[model samples]
Target: MPLGRGYLALAALATTGGLAACGREQQTYCADQNGVVVPDVRCDDGSPGYYYYTGSYGRGRRPGYRLGGGSRIASTDSNGRARAGLPSTGHVSNGHVTSGGFGSSGHGSSGG
Candidate 1:
């Protein structure tokens, strides 16, 4: 027998509900690092990693976490900045580089 429109509507609703339930069964990852909530995922790679909680879309930035060497977890500072071993300059802060040189202003040859 052919199904009635109401029956089809009910079936569709049931299917959607089932799909929603399936989604709910999905996993998520969440972690707290240094007073920062680092979601279960990678901020750079944007992939799911290590843990599940049924509520993670596996997107968005995960604070204190960085994807390095392809799918590896790297440590980050409290400001979410990665720790690197590059040579440090004596005059730089907040991404601005400053230097005292010659023939310009302070702490340089005044062309005497």
Candidate 2:
């Protein structure tokens, strides 16, 4: 039996919906205690961080910030090692801005 147009449309919709849920990218947002924005990857270790999206894979969009004195922030420490519980700072190394810190594995969440 030939499928009705309405049935076909519904089937197509269902398939699309199912496929949408299959391939998704989980998004994580990282922020400091004072609510400053940081790189999402910095929060992967479960430091002071928050979830912009906690569910299955999906398109993630995050806010952008304009650095007042350029995008790079000088590291307070000379060795390039950041304090465990501190937020990721833009450390200048070799004339480039690199993310600083080995994010803490402690349990804490901060809103951005």
Candidate 3:
């Protein structure tokens, strides 16, 4: 026996909705060239060092974010990308971008 078209549609809808549950309300934030959280003004002057960011959905910054669309407004780039050298919005350093940690080289958690 084969599944009905209705069942397939229902399954697809459920899967879409399931992924939507893991989202967060996106808000505008100022960030530097590396995507580090900076004062909101940095993005206002249309300068090079700053850009707009939605803080990556599903990261949970605040509340009341609709499913699907992550941000109300995207960054000011033609391709909708902030820049190539920007930081990863997943970790969310909260303006505390650190470089070169134990995870970088072959270093162990317990010091020798």
lDDT by residue for model 3 (11-80), tens = 9999887666444233444455444556554444445655544433334322222323212122344233
For candidate 2, report its TM-score.
Answer: 0.32
Prediction 2 global C-alpha lDDT: 0.33
Query: Which wins on TM-score, candidate 2 or candidate 3?
Result: 3
User: Which regions of candidate 1 are displaced past 4 Å?
Assistant: 1-3, 24-27, 33-36, 39-54, 64-112
How far off is model 2, as Cα RMSD? Answer: 12.6
How good is model 3 by TM-score? 0.35
The 10 consecutive residues of candidate 2 with the worst lDDT sum are: 66-75
Ranking by lDDT, best first?
Answer: 3, 2, 1
Model 2, 45: alpha-carbon shift in Å? 8.8
Which tens-of-lDDT digit does each residue in 1-112 have in candidate 1? 8999999999999988766654332112223322233533332232333211112223343445432211111222211121121112121111112221221121111111
TM-score to true structure, per model: 0.28, 0.32, 0.35
Highest-scoring model, lDDT: 3
Check candidate 2 and list the clashing pairs.
24-57, 25-58
* Model 2 regions lying over 4 Å from their true place: 33-36, 39-112
Model 1, global lDDT: 0.28
Ranking by TM-score: 3, 2, 1
lDDT of 2 by residue, 1-112 (tens): 9999999999999988877654433222333333344565544444433222221112332334312211111223212123222234442112122222222222232232
Worst 10 residues of 3 by lDDT: 103-112
